[model samples]
Target: MSVRVLLVDDNPVVRIGLRSLLELDDRMDVCGEASSGQEAVAVASRERPDVVLLDVRMPGSGGLDVLPALTQLSRVLMLTYSDEPAVVSEALRGGATGYLVHGAFQSDELAMAIIDTAEGRPRLSPAAASVLLQGFHGGGTAVAEAPATHDRAEPTVVPEVVKQHALSRREVEICRLLVAGMSNGDIARRLFIEEKTVKNHLNRIFAKLGAANRAEAIATCLGTRRGA
Candidate 1:
């Protein structure tokens, strides 16, 4: 079945543009549209879309405000113009599957974000990823546009994943690199594994952590590891 999508943006023009772009992929079908956060929730409840393209600047109930609720029903990839660190951190905390700054994405990037979210692999634009790392780690910014390719630095020690989760040694290593803000390609090259292998490991990692995507995985790891 095509991945059903619900488009939520205050502007009709933006929603139409997204629909046109998403429909280009035969695997995606634009199932509904909503002009506000409340409307988006209502339509999403009725349509039960697999993914939701949600705009952050909606007039009445803001996107972040509805994010915790919307995420319960469908994968939500935030579409916003803001790149502020606080906003990025809050959206992820609010259960956004991915965050993409508007106008930064080409059609392919946007489609990949939606598809990845539906596949339970969170997609973060380089910029979005950079900011989140900064917010969480107080680390320097990530090169947001680093060619989707990039790295093992010093062996950052990761606490053992909860034994009940049954994470392997290599999975724990990969999770540490992910916390270091490495991309799939980066992680694969560093570990001398194929990119597809990195993705497969990530899928298993998410399952073990009870996470829906990379953002959730990162949050879960951070929440648990910080106190360790």
Candidate 2:
């Protein structure tokens, strides 16, 4: 399936460059473009792109400020040059599907990020995750910067930590499997992904739960204190 993208950045040159690169990939399409936050929202409401690639810093009402509005229409991926942890944390809290550093990323990276965002996957770049993890662990200037998830009926399948860490739906699924005592290989087989991917999810899960290891993670998710 082709992913429809709404490119939102103040710079026309950047939008043109991004459109050029995105067109190189056959699975994605640039459906629209916007140069400001309000314009982005209006375009998104009309075009309803599967993913919105938004700049973090834009003139007049920054991208993060418009995030919630756009999210109501489609998933959003933050595209920015700022590597500041605080900025990354704020973007995540505003409900970004992923955060990408424009310069550090390549064409393929952007393509995959779009694909993942369209598929309801959280594409936290390693750099972004490092900063977010610090926030989760009280190291950030604003501690526990958990992202605000979209409004939906709270499912019975969701765990308590859902509100606190904004774990991806896949992450919550993996957490359920962990509670069932599934090993990494077992999770990989069940999820039909590589064990390496499961490991990566576990790392994110543990960090979000502020767990030192599996036991703590499970305990934390269940809202129980460790037996030790």
Candidate 3:
């Protein structure tokens, strides 16, 4: 079955371009188009798309303004030009399933992202990931934070949930970095390992935690920490 997608952007050209790009993939169907947040909500309600590609800015009622409603209808991916950490954080907090900045991904990647989001695996472009990481390091976002303690140098203790999954030490370390919003490449470099190694570890981590993706794994760890 083709994945139903709703395209919401103010620019007609952008909408057309997106439609063209997505149509190339046999797995995607552009179910509807909306030029503003209000129209997006109305169209989404009627079409019941599986995924919504929403722009951050429009003439009125920007993506964020209508996000809560849209998210209720379908999984939303913020496809916009803005990579501002604040905007990214706001969108994620507003229930966006994924965030992809324009120019950060190609058509194929976009198609894959839609599929991933539809399958409940959140996708983030490199720029979006960096923005999230920045917000996390600045201590102003939902990305996991080290437990509050007197010593700033104290290592982030792995959440009990992670341990319950019986993750290896290296897997726990990768999980910690992932919750911090670090990309696979960043985690690989941070741990002085090849990117492929990080991918392998992540696959193992996901299997152990029963997580579908990075976001789910992070959410599991963070939920445990927040409740502690």
- Candidate 2: tens digits of C-alpha lDDT, residues 2-68: 9999999999999999999999899989999999999999999999999999997676666877988
**Which candidate, 2 or 3, has the higher lDDT?**
3
By lDDT, who's the top model here?
Answer: 3
Q: Which of candidates 1 and 3 is the stronger one according to TM-score?
A: 3
Clashing pairs for model 3 are none
Better of 1 and 3 by lDDT: 3
Order of candidates by TM-score, top first? 3, 2, 1
Better of 1 and 2 by lDDT: 2
Which portions of model 1 miss their true places by more than 4 Å?
Answer: 135-228
Candidate 3 backbone overlaps, count: 0
Segments in model 3 whose C-alpha atoms lie over 4 Å from true places: 134-228
**What is the alpha-carbon lDDT of model 3 when measured against the actual structure?**
0.78
RMSD of every candidate to native, in Å, equals 15.6, 16.8, 15.3
lDDT of predicted model 1? 0.75
- Note the Cα lDDT for every prediction shown: 0.75, 0.77, 0.78
* Candidate 2 error regions (>4 Å): 136-228
TM values, all candidates: 0.59, 0.59, 0.60
